[model samples]
Target: MRYEETAQLENPRSSVSTDMMVGTALYTLAIGVFFVVFGLRKRQRWIVFWGATMVVAGAAYVVAIALGVDK
Candidate 1:
């Protein structure tokens, strides 16, 4: 294909939506909470660490989205 066609095909904005981003953030938070609870019950330090990390990242993502920082 031509370079122009390739460039046109790479429209990043069309690849995702704001709602999708929010949904992903929410899903990540849910998974983090699940892991955290399970880790606490099972007394697993690594799982708890990972869960906390993910929870913080997810919270940051959601906050950024809310603040329009992602745009």
Candidate 2:
């Protein structure tokens, strides 16, 4: 592709709607919650750690979207 054309390429994130982003983030949060719960029940520390990370990331994403900082 030409340099100009590449430079003009659209950002995939720019095309995503707020609703879709929120939905995805919410889904991530749900998965995280599930992992945390399941890990606790299974006595698995790693699973809980990953789940907490996911929860933090999802929450951050939601906050970023709300604050209009995603752009």
Candidate 3:
């Protein structure tokens, strides 16, 4: 039997970019708005909750970007 090991970098470079963060936030915001609109039209409580959650996620991403949060 052969065993394989995956090498991990000890010191990794942070590849965070402004464009990526903004793009993700914008996409999330769009999804949230869509859900909110459809939820309102359908009068579904769960859908509205999901919509709110997505909206918060989007806002959080934006705030993290602003706060320089990165891995």
Candidate 4:
């Protein structure tokens, strides 16, 4: 499925609150940062991959909120 469609499907009820959405976005961003830092220090490909993935996830979460999918 497409990213936007997947997001909509995952959050079908649209009952998520602003605080919860913000928290999830923050958590994902933090994880992304951690992975990027660890990847740079340890030179692990997986860490970098996870970091990029988290960044995308964070962006998607924000987009979903902006699109009013999880209101």
Per-candidate Cα lDDT values, in order, are: 0.87, 0.90, 0.88, 0.85
Over 1-71, each residue of candidate 1 has an lDDT whose tens digit, in order, gives: 65554444464556788898789888999999999999999999899999998899889999998898966
Root-mean-square deviation of every model: 3.2, 3.9, 3.5, 10.3
Summed over model 2, clashes come to 0
Candidate 4 residue runs with Cα over 4 Å from true position: 1-16, 67-71
- Can you give the TM-score per candidate against the true fold? 0.77, 0.72, 0.67, 0.61
Top candidate by TM-score: 1
Better of 2 and 3 by lDDT: 2
Name the runs in model 2 displaced over 4 angstroms: 1-15
lDDT of 3 by residue, 1-71 (tens): 98898899998876977787799898998899889899999999899889989999998988888888954
Which candidate order results from sorting by lDDT in descending order?
2, 3, 1, 4
Evaluate residue 52 in candidate 4 and report its C-alpha lDDT on the 0 to 100 scale: 85
- Residue 12: error of model 4 in Å? 12
User: Clash totals for all models, in order?
Assistant: 0, 0, 0, 0
Q: Write down the lDDT that model 1 would get.
A: 0.87
Tell me the tens digit of each residue's lDDT in model 4 across 6-62: 333653665777888779897998899899889989999999999989988998888
For model 4, give the RMSD to the true fold.
10.3
TM-score, candidate 3, is 0.67
Which ten-residue region of model 3 has the weakest summed lDDT? 62-71
